[model samples]
Target: MLKFTTNLILLFISVTAFAQDSLSVETAAIDTVQVQQASKDSTVYKQRYGLRVGIDLSKPLRSFLEEDYQGLELLADFRISHNVYIAGALGNEEKTTQEDNYNFTTSGSYLKVGLDWNTYENWYGMENIINLGFRVGASTFSQTLNAYQIYNTNQYWNEIQSGIMGEDMLGEYSGLNALWAEIVLGMKVELFRNVFMGASVRLNYLVNNTQAGNFPNLFIPGFNKVTDGSKFGVGYNYSISYLIPIFKGNKPQKLPSNNQQEQED
Candidate 1:
């Protein structure tokens, strides 16, 4: 009887220890799952959305350095989505060009509206962008024929001196305008918090314009130099900008793997 009682007591003790071990294992599993869920929730990132305003630094620098050029440009953009922005520029320019046969001045104000699609994939907390963009540009401008020498194909004949032109030909041609479109490729780097520096190269295609009767449109204000019988031009800008944060949105977070979670725990 004593031997039987001792065996029964040993079996009961073994069962109780097994039950305790099983309960402990279940509790540990529940704790681990909760930890992983909390970690994922905490890892979500927040992105800033805002309006950014800037100035084209190259224009003012050119105005100061070049005697025949004066220009100013203001730029702005608003974030509409991740990797996309609505952007535009407003500017005024006056340029004097001395050609082989003529000297002319172009003065005008232009407006460009566009969208920038950022192609760069940034790391966490970085807002730098490499973008491809397009613009529709319009300008209202005037051209003045300062001086011109009449063209003579024959070298044997003495050429008329430059700056000797009729009064009608030396006057300003007003009420002139042009329309153009451009493809822009550029980058913006964040130099400081909410401050960015950017540069872009533009390939412009002239769509339409009104030309002076006697003088052709050799140079346009916003579109730059116009080639004879060609509808293409080129431009560039360097800018500095400031951002005003308006709101924030959540960015998707990458979750850790099981091994990483275990290591973290």
Candidate 2:
């Protein structure tokens, strides 16, 4: 009877120890799961920020195509307030035309300021984006109309080609300026974790018309001196850009205080 009682006591102790070990293992797994979830949340928040700096490519409208004109913009984006970025940009567009009658190139650079309103939040892979914006800026515009007629290799600008042949150009001039309004649509996609590719389109119209007769009778922004048998017009821009993230730092957030309280409960 004494031996049998001893065996029963040992079996009871074994069962209790096993139950305790199982409970400890379950608790450890629960703690591990919570840590992993918190880690994920921190990772997501790291991607959130209020500023982005980048560049832009602009292709002017039809009137700008015939000339060797393409524009590039340098930008600074600031988030003085949530979901809104106030920005400043400097840009340049170069136009070149060569023909039997005329050979010339005109390059333009301008300073710009604008506001961006971002309403898109859920679009994945679209951290670099073009919020709706309005831009008003001034550019010191200049052009050289060197030839009586420029050859149209692509047949893209027949009107300008014919004007050059007519020798309607009087001379080239500097000291022209114009104010412009831009409607821009732009976005960026990630090529790597910190590198992104971007593109934008803009509609640019000159607010002032100052014409130069001495230069070829080609249309140039802000240089519309007169409408004497020459046509002055607006332009469009198609641009591509790259965004590189600099100065990335790791910041870890502590778990919410309520979580510990709930786990204790």
Candidate 3:
């Protein structure tokens, strides 16, 4: 009977120990989940959203390198959403071109307004951008007819094209205007703290142009060249900019753990 009683006592002790071990394991799991939840609640990361302003470095460099070209442009953008930016540019240009039959100078100011969408997905803490954007551009300018040759196809009298001095023909025409739209593809890399360098190529289509009476506009300020038969033009700009952070936005919340949540449920 003593042996049977001792055996019962051993069995009771084993059961009690097993129960305590199970309780301890459950308590540990609960505490782990509570700590994770607290961490999630306490940790928050925000993204910087702000305005960026800069200058077109290409235009200034061109003006310095070329005697007949002078240009300046200002670029700016404001981040309104995670990938959307409201952007624009303002500039003035004066260029002189000498063609086989004519020489002309164009001078004017232009403005472009548009929006850019960042298409690239960046790693955390990186602000590099690949963007596709659109803009509506307008310009008010003047053209000076330097010189031209009138095409005379009549070789019967051994007379070919006749050269005419631009001073004799209406010298300068003012109050000319043009409007266009552009699609811009660009990339920007952050080179230093809040400083970025970028490049963009623009495909422009002419919407309307006010011809200067009898002289066709050979070159519109922002809209580069006007060929005899084409309405499309191409341009590019290299830029440097500084970003100003106006505010910060919370990043998207991470999804919860499935196993831990299932245990709690």
Candidate 4:
């Protein structure tokens, strides 16, 4: 009976040691996994932040194809934060319009300043943007009274003139200016490396204009045509820009698993 008890006690000790060894191994394995996860969580990715400069692709291309329109526009933006950018455009336009009783030309340069908000949630390693923007714009431009035939309601006199009114008609209407505001919707896609392609549509409201005497302001350079009773205009641009990365930013990392964190603590 004593011998039997001794053997049983020895077996119990051996089993307990084995169980303790197994537990230790499991604990060590868990600690190793936690360490690996923590290391992965500490990894950082640098985001690109900089100034982007480009030209309006549509304007130049249109100028090449349209005889009545010639335009050039430069676009630029500086990324100030993760989802915010300061943007603007500088442009010159000369457009000729022929109407039933008039043909006129408007030429001018304009500048706009605005801010853009990026609304897209990009995937990992992707930096495309869907944006909503606002701008306040001003233009200094002039209109030329090219040629006009006086529209007389009474046709009693068959005299219709279709040439410039006088020597003073073909020159610029100096000091004519305008101010406006716009809401823009756009998207930018990274095409290759730091190059991007973007398009935006603008809804504009004319705030004010300085017109020339006798002849109404038919067209304002950046604001487009002035309608009979409407103060609104619509415009759009397609662009290709190159980003010059000025700095790198790091996005906030996600938190580690609570259970793992607690175990570590």
TM-score of each: 0.80, 0.51, 0.79, 0.78
**Residue 153, candidate 2: how far off, in angstroms?**
25
lDDT of 3 at 157: 66
The models' CA-based lDDT, in order, is 0.91, 0.58, 0.90, 0.88
The per-prediction CA RMSD against the true structure, in angstroms, equals 6.1, 13.0, 7.9, 7.9
Across 1-265, the per-residue lDDT of candidate 1 in tens digits comes to: 9999999999999999999999999999999999988886556678889999999999999999999999999999999999999999999999999998788899999999999999998866789999999999999999999887775566555655433455558889998999999999999999999999999999999999999887888887778899988999999999999999999988875665668789989
Ten-residue region with minimum lDDT total, candidate 4: 161-170
Quote model 4's TM-score.
0.78
lDDT of 2 by residue, 179-200 (tens): 6676666655556654556654
* Residue 118 lDDT, candidate 4, scale 0-100: 97
The positional error of residue 116 in candidate 4, measured at the CA in angstroms, is 0.4
Which candidate number maximizes TM-score?
Answer: 1
Among residues 3 or more apart in sequence or in different chains, the pairs in candidate 3 whose N, CA or C atoms overlap within 3 Å are none
Candidate 4 lDDT? 0.88
- For model 4, state the Cα shift of residue 217 in Å: 2.0
Clashing pairs in 1: none
